[model samples]
Target: MNKYATCPISTNRINERVARLNGLFTFLLIMLFIITRLWYIPAFLAFDFLMRSINLSKFSPLAYLSKGIVKLLQLKKKFINAGPKIFAARIGLLVSSAIFIFSLIGFNITAIVLASVLALFSFLETAFGFCVACEMYPYLNRFLNRLQ
Candidate 1:
Protein backbone atom coordinates (compact mmCIF):
# COMPACT_ATOMS: atom_id res chain seq x y z
CA MET A 1 0.00 0.00 0.00
CA ASN A 2 1.18 3.52 -0.76
CA LYS A 3 2.10 5.61 2.24
CA TYR A 4 -0.23 8.54 2.96
CA ALA A 5 -2.73 7.44 0.36
CA THR A 6 -5.44 9.19 2.28
CA CYS A 7 -3.56 12.45 2.60
CA PRO A 8 -4.76 14.86 -0.03
CA ILE A 9 -2.67 17.84 -0.95
CA SER A 10 -5.73 20.00 -1.59
CA THR A 11 -9.48 19.85 -1.28
CA ASN A 12 -12.58 21.81 -2.25
CA ARG A 13 -10.99 25.17 -1.79
CA ILE A 14 -9.65 28.01 -3.89
CA ASN A 15 -6.79 30.34 -2.99
CA GLU A 16 -6.96 34.10 -2.73
CA ARG A 17 -5.25 34.36 -6.09
CA VAL A 18 -8.19 32.82 -7.88
CA ALA A 19 -10.67 34.80 -5.86
CA ARG A 20 -8.91 38.09 -6.51
CA LEU A 21 -8.62 37.36 -10.20
CA ASN A 22 -12.32 36.65 -10.36
CA GLY A 23 -12.93 39.96 -8.67
CA LEU A 24 -10.81 41.74 -11.23
CA PHE A 25 -12.76 40.12 -14.02
CA THR A 26 -16.02 41.30 -12.50
CA PHE A 27 -14.64 44.78 -11.99
CA LEU A 28 -13.66 45.07 -15.63
CA LEU A 29 -17.01 43.81 -16.81
CA ILE A 30 -18.73 46.36 -14.61
CA MET A 31 -16.69 49.10 -16.18
CA LEU A 32 -17.55 47.88 -19.64
CA PHE A 33 -21.20 47.91 -18.73
CA ILE A 34 -20.95 51.48 -17.53
CA ILE A 35 -18.90 52.74 -20.45
CA THR A 36 -21.77 52.23 -22.94
CA ARG A 37 -19.50 52.10 -26.01
CA LEU A 38 -18.80 48.41 -25.69
CA TRP A 39 -22.21 46.90 -26.13
CA TYR A 40 -20.85 43.47 -26.85
CA ILE A 41 -19.05 43.31 -23.52
CA PRO A 42 -22.16 42.18 -21.70
CA ALA A 43 -22.64 39.41 -24.25
CA PHE A 44 -19.08 38.30 -23.64
CA LEU A 45 -19.73 38.45 -19.91
CA ALA A 46 -22.78 36.27 -20.47
CA PHE A 47 -20.49 33.71 -22.04
CA ASP A 48 -18.08 34.03 -19.13
CA PHE A 49 -20.97 33.42 -16.77
CA LEU A 50 -21.78 30.26 -18.67
CA MET A 51 -18.18 29.15 -18.39
CA ARG A 52 -17.91 29.84 -14.67
CA SER A 53 -21.38 28.57 -13.76
CA ILE A 54 -20.51 25.31 -15.45
CA ASN A 55 -17.26 25.09 -13.42
CA LEU A 56 -14.98 25.64 -16.40
CA SER A 57 -12.95 28.51 -15.02
CA LYS A 58 -9.72 26.75 -15.91
CA PHE A 59 -10.49 27.29 -19.59
CA SER A 60 -11.38 30.94 -19.10
CA PRO A 61 -9.05 33.59 -20.50
CA LEU A 62 -9.56 35.78 -17.47
CA ALA A 63 -8.43 32.90 -15.32
CA TYR A 64 -5.19 32.88 -17.22
CA LEU A 65 -4.74 36.57 -16.64
CA SER A 66 -5.44 36.14 -12.95
CA LYS A 67 -2.92 33.34 -12.77
CA GLY A 68 -0.43 35.64 -14.35
CA ILE A 69 -1.22 38.27 -11.76
CA VAL A 70 -0.80 35.78 -8.98
CA LYS A 71 2.60 34.79 -10.27
CA LEU A 72 3.67 38.38 -10.83
CA LEU A 73 2.67 39.42 -7.33
CA GLN A 74 4.07 36.29 -5.70
CA LEU A 75 0.82 35.97 -3.84
CA LYS A 76 0.53 33.00 -1.54
CA LYS A 77 -2.24 30.51 -2.12
CA LYS A 78 -4.36 30.47 0.98
CA PHE A 79 -7.04 27.95 0.23
CA ILE A 80 -10.51 28.31 1.68
CA ASN A 81 -13.63 26.22 1.19
CA ALA A 82 -14.79 26.38 -2.42
CA GLY A 83 -18.48 25.88 -1.66
CA PRO A 84 -19.06 29.49 -0.76
CA LYS A 85 -17.24 30.75 -3.80
CA ILE A 86 -19.22 28.48 -6.06
CA PHE A 87 -22.42 29.78 -4.55
CA ALA A 88 -21.16 33.32 -5.07
CA ALA A 89 -20.32 32.56 -8.68
CA ARG A 90 -23.84 31.30 -9.26
CA ILE A 91 -25.21 34.52 -7.85
CA GLY A 92 -22.88 36.44 -10.08
CA LEU A 93 -23.99 34.38 -13.05
CA LEU A 94 -27.61 35.19 -12.42
CA VAL A 95 -26.89 38.89 -12.18
CA SER A 96 -24.80 38.88 -15.32
CA SER A 97 -27.41 36.91 -17.22
CA ALA A 98 -30.10 39.33 -16.17
CA ILE A 99 -27.94 42.25 -17.22
CA PHE A 100 -27.33 40.65 -20.57
CA ILE A 101 -31.02 40.09 -21.22
CA PHE A 102 -31.97 43.57 -20.11
CA SER A 103 -29.32 45.18 -22.24
CA LEU A 104 -30.29 43.15 -25.27
CA ILE A 105 -33.88 44.31 -24.83
CA GLY A 106 -32.70 47.92 -24.51
CA PHE A 107 -33.75 48.19 -20.92
CA ASN A 108 -30.62 50.20 -20.28
CA ILE A 109 -31.59 51.55 -16.87
CA THR A 110 -32.35 48.16 -15.42
CA ALA A 111 -29.17 46.74 -16.87
CA ILE A 112 -27.17 49.57 -15.40
CA VAL A 113 -28.66 49.02 -11.97
CA LEU A 114 -27.89 45.34 -11.98
CA ALA A 115 -24.41 45.91 -13.32
CA SER A 116 -23.75 48.51 -10.66
CA VAL A 117 -24.79 46.11 -7.96
CA LEU A 118 -22.45 43.51 -9.42
CA ALA A 119 -19.72 46.12 -9.50
CA LEU A 120 -20.26 46.81 -5.83
CA PHE A 121 -20.00 43.13 -5.05
CA SER A 122 -16.78 42.77 -7.01
CA PHE A 123 -15.30 45.89 -5.54
CA LEU A 124 -16.00 44.58 -2.07
CA GLU A 125 -14.29 41.32 -2.84
CA THR A 126 -11.28 42.99 -4.37
CA ALA A 127 -10.82 45.86 -1.98
CA PHE A 128 -12.21 44.53 1.26
CA GLY A 129 -12.08 40.76 0.97
CA PHE A 130 -15.85 40.70 1.39
CA CYS A 131 -18.14 38.47 -0.63
CA VAL A 132 -21.80 39.25 -0.21
CA ALA A 133 -22.97 36.20 -2.09
CA CYS A 134 -20.68 33.92 -0.15
CA GLU A 135 -21.83 35.46 3.09
CA MET A 136 -25.44 34.91 2.15
CA TYR A 137 -25.05 31.25 1.23
CA PRO A 138 -25.43 29.81 4.72
CA TYR A 139 -28.47 31.90 5.57
CA LEU A 140 -30.02 31.17 2.23
CA ASN A 141 -29.39 27.48 2.67
CA ARG A 142 -31.03 27.43 6.05
CA PHE A 143 -33.97 29.39 4.73
CA LEU A 144 -34.43 26.98 1.83
CA ASN A 145 -34.15 23.97 4.08
CA ARG A 146 -36.77 25.45 6.32
CA LEU A 147 -39.05 25.81 3.29
CA GLN A 148 -38.66 22.13 2.59
Candidate 2:
Protein backbone atom coordinates (compact mmCIF):
# COMPACT_ATOMS: atom_id res chain seq x y z
CA MET A 1 0.00 0.00 0.00
CA ASN A 2 1.16 3.51 -0.70
CA LYS A 3 2.17 5.34 2.46
CA TYR A 4 0.55 8.61 1.45
CA ALA A 5 -2.43 7.19 -0.39
CA THR A 6 -4.96 9.45 1.25
CA CYS A 7 -2.93 12.65 1.49
CA PRO A 8 -4.55 15.79 0.14
CA ILE A 9 -3.39 17.16 -3.22
CA SER A 10 -4.16 20.35 -5.12
CA THR A 11 -2.81 22.42 -7.99
CA ASN A 12 -3.40 25.61 -6.03
CA ARG A 13 -0.35 27.22 -4.45
CA ILE A 14 0.33 29.64 -1.59
CA ASN A 15 3.27 31.59 -0.24
CA GLU A 16 5.15 29.58 2.36
CA ARG A 17 6.60 32.65 4.05
CA VAL A 18 3.21 34.23 4.56
CA ALA A 19 1.80 30.97 5.82
CA ARG A 20 4.62 30.68 8.37
CA LEU A 21 4.03 34.25 9.44
CA ASN A 22 0.38 33.44 9.92
CA GLY A 23 1.44 30.52 12.10
CA LEU A 24 3.48 32.91 14.24
CA PHE A 25 0.48 35.17 14.60
CA THR A 26 -1.70 32.22 15.55
CA PHE A 27 0.80 31.13 18.20
CA LEU A 28 0.87 34.63 19.65
CA LEU A 29 -2.90 34.85 19.80
CA ILE A 30 -3.15 31.47 21.50
CA MET A 31 -0.57 32.56 24.04
CA LEU A 32 -2.48 35.77 24.59
CA PHE A 33 -5.62 33.76 25.28
CA ILE A 34 -3.70 31.53 27.69
CA ILE A 35 -2.32 34.53 29.55
CA THR A 36 -5.49 36.59 29.69
CA ARG A 37 -8.00 33.74 29.75
CA LEU A 38 -9.93 35.79 27.22
CA TRP A 39 -12.62 33.75 25.50
CA TYR A 40 -12.92 36.24 22.67
CA ILE A 41 -9.37 35.54 21.52
CA PRO A 42 -10.17 31.95 20.74
CA ALA A 43 -13.45 32.99 19.18
CA PHE A 44 -11.61 35.36 16.90
CA LEU A 45 -9.08 32.70 16.02
CA ALA A 46 -11.86 30.25 15.22
CA PHE A 47 -13.42 32.79 12.88
CA ASP A 48 -10.10 33.50 11.22
CA PHE A 49 -9.48 29.80 10.74
CA LEU A 50 -12.92 29.40 9.26
CA MET A 51 -12.15 32.09 6.70
CA ARG A 52 -8.90 30.44 5.71
CA SER A 53 -10.45 27.01 5.58
CA ILE A 54 -13.12 28.22 3.19
CA ASN A 55 -10.57 29.63 0.71
CA LEU A 56 -11.52 33.13 1.76
CA SER A 57 -8.10 33.91 3.19
CA LYS A 58 -8.35 37.55 2.17
CA PHE A 59 -10.96 37.89 4.92
CA SER A 60 -8.75 36.37 7.59
CA PRO A 61 -7.14 38.92 9.88
CA LEU A 62 -4.08 36.75 10.41
CA ALA A 63 -3.63 36.36 6.67
CA TYR A 64 -3.86 40.10 6.17
CA LEU A 65 -1.31 40.76 8.86
CA SER A 66 1.04 38.08 7.60
CA LYS A 67 0.83 39.36 4.05
CA GLY A 68 1.63 42.88 5.16
CA ILE A 69 4.60 41.70 7.16
CA VAL A 70 5.90 39.64 4.27
CA LYS A 71 5.65 42.58 1.91
CA LEU A 72 7.29 44.94 4.39
CA LEU A 73 10.14 42.50 4.86
CA GLN A 74 10.49 41.96 1.12
CA LEU A 75 10.44 38.22 1.63
CA LYS A 76 10.59 36.22 -1.56
CA LYS A 77 7.49 34.12 -2.03
CA LYS A 78 7.95 30.37 -1.90
CA PHE A 79 4.98 28.64 -3.37
CA ILE A 80 3.63 25.43 -1.88
CA ASN A 81 0.64 23.19 -2.44
CA ALA A 82 -2.48 24.69 -0.85
CA GLY A 83 -4.25 21.42 -0.14
CA PRO A 84 -2.32 20.55 3.04
CA LYS A 85 -2.59 24.09 4.31
CA ILE A 86 -6.33 24.11 3.69
CA PHE A 87 -6.63 20.86 5.63
CA ALA A 88 -4.61 22.39 8.43
CA ALA A 89 -6.90 25.41 8.53
CA ARG A 90 -9.92 23.16 8.96
CA ILE A 91 -8.21 21.47 11.90
CA GLY A 92 -7.37 24.87 13.31
CA LEU A 93 -10.99 25.94 13.07
CA LEU A 94 -12.10 22.88 15.03
CA VAL A 95 -9.45 23.27 17.72
CA SER A 96 -10.06 26.99 18.16
CA SER A 97 -13.81 26.43 18.33
CA ALA A 98 -13.33 23.75 20.97
CA ILE A 99 -11.08 26.03 22.96
CA PHE A 100 -13.62 28.80 22.84
CA ILE A 101 -16.40 26.46 23.94
CA PHE A 102 -14.31 24.97 26.71
CA SER A 103 -13.51 28.41 28.02
CA LEU A 104 -17.17 29.36 27.94
CA ILE A 105 -18.06 26.20 29.85
CA GLY A 106 -15.53 26.97 32.61
CA PHE A 107 -13.28 24.11 31.66
CA ASN A 108 -10.16 26.18 32.20
CA ILE A 109 -7.70 23.31 32.48
CA THR A 110 -8.95 21.54 29.38
CA ALA A 111 -8.91 24.77 27.44
CA ILE A 112 -5.41 25.57 28.57
CA VAL A 113 -4.13 22.14 27.64
CA LEU A 114 -5.72 22.31 24.23
CA ALA A 115 -4.43 25.80 23.64
CA SER A 116 -0.96 24.72 24.66
CA VAL A 117 -1.04 21.92 22.12
CA LEU A 118 -2.20 24.37 19.47
CA ALA A 119 0.51 26.80 20.43
CA LEU A 120 3.10 24.05 20.12
CA PHE A 121 1.83 23.12 16.68
CA SER A 122 1.84 26.73 15.53
CA PHE A 123 5.29 27.25 16.93
CA LEU A 124 6.52 24.22 15.02
CA GLU A 125 5.07 25.61 11.81
CA THR A 126 6.48 29.05 12.37
CA ALA A 127 9.91 28.01 13.50
CA PHE A 128 10.51 24.85 11.51
CA GLY A 129 7.94 24.85 8.72
CA PHE A 130 6.68 21.56 10.12
CA CYS A 131 2.94 21.03 9.83
CA VAL A 132 1.59 18.48 12.25
CA ALA A 133 -1.87 18.61 10.73
CA CYS A 134 -0.46 17.82 7.29
CA GLU A 135 1.52 14.93 8.71
CA MET A 136 -1.58 13.52 10.38
CA TYR A 137 -3.80 13.95 7.32
CA PRO A 138 -2.98 10.63 5.64
CA TYR A 139 -3.52 8.62 8.78
CA LEU A 140 -6.74 10.45 9.57
CA ASN A 141 -7.96 9.99 6.03
CA ARG A 142 -7.23 6.27 6.14
CA PHE A 143 -9.02 5.91 9.47
CA LEU A 144 -12.08 7.76 8.24
CA ASN A 145 -12.16 5.68 5.05
CA ARG A 146 -12.10 2.52 7.13
CA LEU A 147 -15.01 3.80 9.21
CA GLN A 148 -17.15 4.48 6.15
Candidate 3:
Protein backbone atom coordinates (compact mmCIF):
# COMPACT_ATOMS: atom_id res chain seq x y z
CA MET A 1 0.00 0.00 0.00
CA ASN A 2 1.31 3.46 -0.84
CA LYS A 3 1.85 5.85 2.00
CA TYR A 4 -0.26 8.50 0.32
CA ALA A 5 -3.10 6.34 -0.99
CA THR A 6 -6.46 7.93 -0.44
CA CYS A 7 -9.02 6.66 2.17
CA PRO A 8 -7.03 8.57 4.87
CA ILE A 9 -6.81 5.00 6.04
CA SER A 10 -3.26 4.20 6.89
CA THR A 11 -2.44 0.54 7.38
CA ASN A 12 -2.15 -2.52 5.22
CA ARG A 13 -4.44 -3.99 7.80
CA ILE A 14 -8.02 -3.38 6.82
CA ASN A 15 -9.55 -0.41 8.64
CA GLU A 16 -12.79 -0.39 10.65
CA ARG A 17 -14.76 1.77 8.24
CA VAL A 18 -13.72 -0.29 5.24
CA ALA A 19 -14.70 -3.44 7.06
CA ARG A 20 -18.12 -2.16 8.07
CA LEU A 21 -18.88 -0.81 4.64
CA ASN A 22 -17.67 -3.91 2.86
CA GLY A 23 -19.72 -6.07 5.16
CA LEU A 24 -22.87 -4.06 4.76
CA PHE A 25 -22.43 -3.83 1.01
CA THR A 26 -21.80 -7.53 0.62
CA PHE A 27 -24.78 -8.50 2.74
CA LEU A 28 -27.14 -6.12 1.01
CA LEU A 29 -25.89 -6.76 -2.51
CA ILE A 30 -26.26 -10.49 -2.16
CA MET A 31 -29.68 -10.15 -0.64
CA LEU A 32 -30.77 -7.83 -3.43
CA PHE A 33 -29.32 -10.03 -6.15
CA ILE A 34 -31.22 -13.07 -4.92
CA ILE A 35 -34.59 -11.44 -5.35
CA THR A 36 -33.95 -10.78 -9.09
CA ARG A 37 -34.07 -7.12 -8.27
CA LEU A 38 -32.59 -4.52 -10.61
CA TRP A 39 -32.12 -2.16 -7.72
CA TYR A 40 -29.13 -4.21 -6.63
CA ILE A 41 -27.19 -3.31 -9.74
CA PRO A 42 -27.19 0.40 -9.07
CA ALA A 43 -26.65 -0.18 -5.39
CA PHE A 44 -23.70 -2.34 -6.22
CA LEU A 45 -22.38 0.15 -8.73
CA ALA A 46 -22.62 2.92 -6.22
CA PHE A 47 -20.58 0.94 -3.75
CA ASP A 48 -17.37 1.12 -5.74
CA PHE A 49 -17.92 4.79 -6.28
CA LEU A 50 -18.42 5.34 -2.57
CA MET A 51 -15.33 3.36 -1.82
CA ARG A 52 -13.43 5.33 -4.42
CA SER A 53 -14.56 8.61 -2.94
CA ILE A 54 -13.12 7.38 0.32
CA ASN A 55 -10.18 5.89 -1.58
CA LEU A 56 -10.98 2.25 -0.90
CA SER A 57 -11.60 0.57 -4.23
CA LYS A 58 -8.59 1.60 -6.28
CA PHE A 59 -8.06 -0.52 -9.41
CA SER A 60 -11.29 -2.47 -9.35
CA PRO A 61 -13.44 -3.57 -12.29
CA LEU A 62 -14.58 -0.07 -13.15
CA ALA A 63 -11.04 1.14 -13.24
CA TYR A 64 -10.12 -1.87 -15.33
CA LEU A 65 -13.05 -1.20 -17.60
CA SER A 66 -12.04 2.40 -18.05
CA LYS A 67 -8.51 1.47 -18.97
CA GLY A 68 -9.81 -1.20 -21.30
CA ILE A 69 -12.13 1.27 -22.95
CA VAL A 70 -9.20 3.46 -23.84
CA LYS A 71 -5.76 2.00 -23.79
CA LEU A 72 -4.28 5.44 -24.22
CA LEU A 73 -6.30 6.87 -21.38
CA GLN A 74 -4.01 7.05 -18.44
CA LEU A 75 -5.51 5.68 -15.27
CA LYS A 76 -5.14 7.95 -12.27
CA LYS A 77 -1.81 7.39 -10.56
CA LYS A 78 -3.54 6.12 -7.42
CA PHE A 79 -5.95 3.94 -9.39
CA ILE A 80 -3.82 0.82 -9.51
CA ASN A 81 -2.72 0.66 -5.92
CA ALA A 82 -5.08 -1.77 -4.23
CA GLY A 83 -5.11 -1.85 -0.44
CA PRO A 84 -5.69 -5.00 1.62
CA LYS A 85 -9.14 -4.05 2.88
CA ILE A 86 -10.32 -3.18 -0.59
CA PHE A 87 -8.85 -6.40 -1.86
CA ALA A 88 -10.87 -8.34 0.68
CA ALA A 89 -13.95 -6.45 -0.38
CA ARG A 90 -13.19 -7.23 -4.02
CA ILE A 91 -12.83 -10.94 -3.41
CA GLY A 92 -15.89 -11.19 -1.19
CA LEU A 93 -17.98 -9.31 -3.67
CA LEU A 94 -16.71 -11.49 -6.50
CA VAL A 95 -17.81 -14.67 -4.75
CA SER A 96 -21.14 -13.31 -3.60
CA SER A 97 -21.77 -11.77 -7.00
CA ALA A 98 -21.45 -15.19 -8.60
CA ILE A 99 -23.91 -16.63 -6.16
CA PHE A 100 -26.30 -13.81 -7.01
CA ILE A 101 -26.08 -14.60 -10.71
CA PHE A 102 -26.47 -18.32 -10.09
CA SER A 103 -29.68 -17.71 -8.17
CA LEU A 104 -31.31 -16.43 -11.36
CA ILE A 105 -32.10 -19.89 -12.68
CA GLY A 106 -34.39 -20.41 -9.74
CA PHE A 107 -34.60 -19.63 -6.08
CA ASN A 108 -32.04 -22.02 -4.76
CA ILE A 109 -33.02 -22.04 -1.14
CA THR A 110 -29.73 -23.58 -0.17
CA ALA A 111 -27.85 -20.88 -1.98
CA ILE A 112 -29.95 -18.18 -0.43
CA VAL A 113 -29.34 -19.55 3.01
CA LEU A 114 -25.63 -19.86 2.34
CA ALA A 115 -25.43 -16.35 0.96
CA SER A 116 -27.31 -14.94 3.90
CA VAL A 117 -24.81 -16.58 6.15
CA LEU A 118 -21.99 -15.02 4.18
CA ALA A 119 -23.68 -11.67 4.49
CA LEU A 120 -23.75 -12.03 8.23
CA PHE A 121 -20.05 -12.64 8.06
CA SER A 122 -19.53 -9.38 6.25
CA PHE A 123 -21.51 -7.81 9.00
CA LEU A 124 -19.32 -9.44 11.54
CA GLU A 125 -16.17 -8.05 10.02
CA THR A 126 -17.22 -4.76 11.48
CA ALA A 127 -16.80 -6.11 14.97
CA PHE A 128 -14.43 -9.03 14.66
CA GLY A 129 -12.37 -8.10 11.63
CA PHE A 130 -13.02 -11.62 10.43
CA CYS A 131 -12.39 -12.05 6.73
CA VAL A 132 -13.16 -15.67 5.97
CA ALA A 133 -12.42 -15.38 2.27
CA CYS A 134 -9.12 -13.59 2.75
CA GLU A 135 -8.13 -16.26 5.21
CA MET A 136 -8.95 -18.93 2.66
CA TYR A 137 -7.39 -17.24 -0.36
CA PRO A 138 -3.85 -18.16 0.51
CA TYR A 139 -4.51 -21.84 1.07
CA LEU A 140 -6.71 -22.01 -2.00
CA ASN A 141 -4.05 -20.32 -4.08
CA ARG A 142 -1.40 -22.67 -2.84
CA PHE A 143 -3.54 -25.68 -3.57
CA LEU A 144 -4.43 -24.50 -7.07
CA ASN A 145 -0.85 -23.62 -7.78
CA ARG A 146 0.24 -27.06 -6.71
CA LEU A 147 -2.31 -28.64 -9.00
CA GLN A 148 -0.96 -26.72 -11.93
Top candidate when judged by TM-score against the true structure = 2
- Model 1's number of clashes is 0
lDDT of 2 by residue, 63-95 (tens): 999999999999999999999999999999999
lDDT of each: 0.75, 0.96, 0.51
Once fitted onto the true fold, the runs of candidate 3 whose alpha carbons sit more than 4 angstroms away are 1-14, 28-83
List, residue by residue over 74-130, the lDDT tens digit for candidate 1. 888888766666677778878888888888888888989988998999999988888
Ranking by TM-score: 2, 1, 3
Compared with the true structure, the alpha-carbon lDDT of candidate 1 equals 0.75
Q: After superposition, how far is residue 90 of candidate 3 from its true place, in Å?
A: 3.5
Give lDDT tens digits, candidate 3, residues 32-134: 7557544445345445545543554454445344434344553322222235455455555554555545455554675566566666766666557665655
- Runs of candidate 1 with Cα error greater than 4 angstroms are 1-10
> Cα RMSDs of all predictions?
7.1, 0.8, 10.6
Please report the candidate that would top lDDT against the real structure: 2
Clashing pairs in 3: none
